[model samples]
Target: MTYMVLLAASFGYVFLKAWQQRNVAFDHVWWVLPTSYAMAVVEVIVVTKIVMTGGNWLAVFVLGTGGGFGALTAMWFHKTFLTRRE
Candidate 1:
C-alpha cells in the first residue's frame, strides 16, 4: 500500500514537472516545485529500501514495477485532469 501510494505520487510529479517545462517559455508553475520535492522524497525512500535489501534482482524488478506503475498513474492523471484543448 505504501509503495503504491508513493509510486503514484512519484510518477505524477514527474509527469507534472515535465509538462511544466515543456509547455512554458519563461513562466513558472508554483506547484511544480512541491511536486518535485515530493518525488525526491519518495525516490529516496524507494532507493533506501532497494539498497538495504541487498540490491538483488527481485528487488530491482519490484522497483521497476513500481516505476512503471508510477508512469501509468501519471499518464492517467495527465489525460484525465491536466489536458486541455488549446
Candidate 2:
C-alpha cells in the first residue's frame, strides 16, 4: 500500500516539477518556487525509502517507471495546456 501510494506520488510530483520548469523558463514564477520546494521534499522521502529498502529491485523499477511516465506526461501536459499556439 505504501509503495503503491509512493509510486503514484512520485510520478505525479515529478510531472508537476517538470511542468513547473517549463513555466519558469517562460517567466512563470507563480508556481515555480512552491513546486521547487515540493520537489525537494518528495525527492528526499523517495531517496530515503529506496536506501532504507536496501535498493530493492522492485522499488528501483517503480521509481524508474514513475520517472519515465512523469517526463512524458509533463511534455504532453505542457503542450496541451501551457503552450500558446500561433
Runs in model 1 deviating more than 4 A are 1-28
Q: Lowest-scoring 10 consecutive residues by lDDT in candidate 2? A: 1-10
Q: What is candidate 1's lDDT per residue for 1-86, written digit by digit as tens?
A: 54554455445545555544533433435556776676677667766665566767766566666557656665666556656646
Tens digits of per-residue lDDT for model 2 on 1-71? Answer: 65775577679768877888788786767768887888888888777767666777888788778877997
Model 2 misplaced regions, further than 4 Å:
none
Query: TM-scores across all candidates?
Result: 0.65, 0.77
lDDT of each: 0.57, 0.78
- Candidate with the greatest TM-score versus the true structure: 2
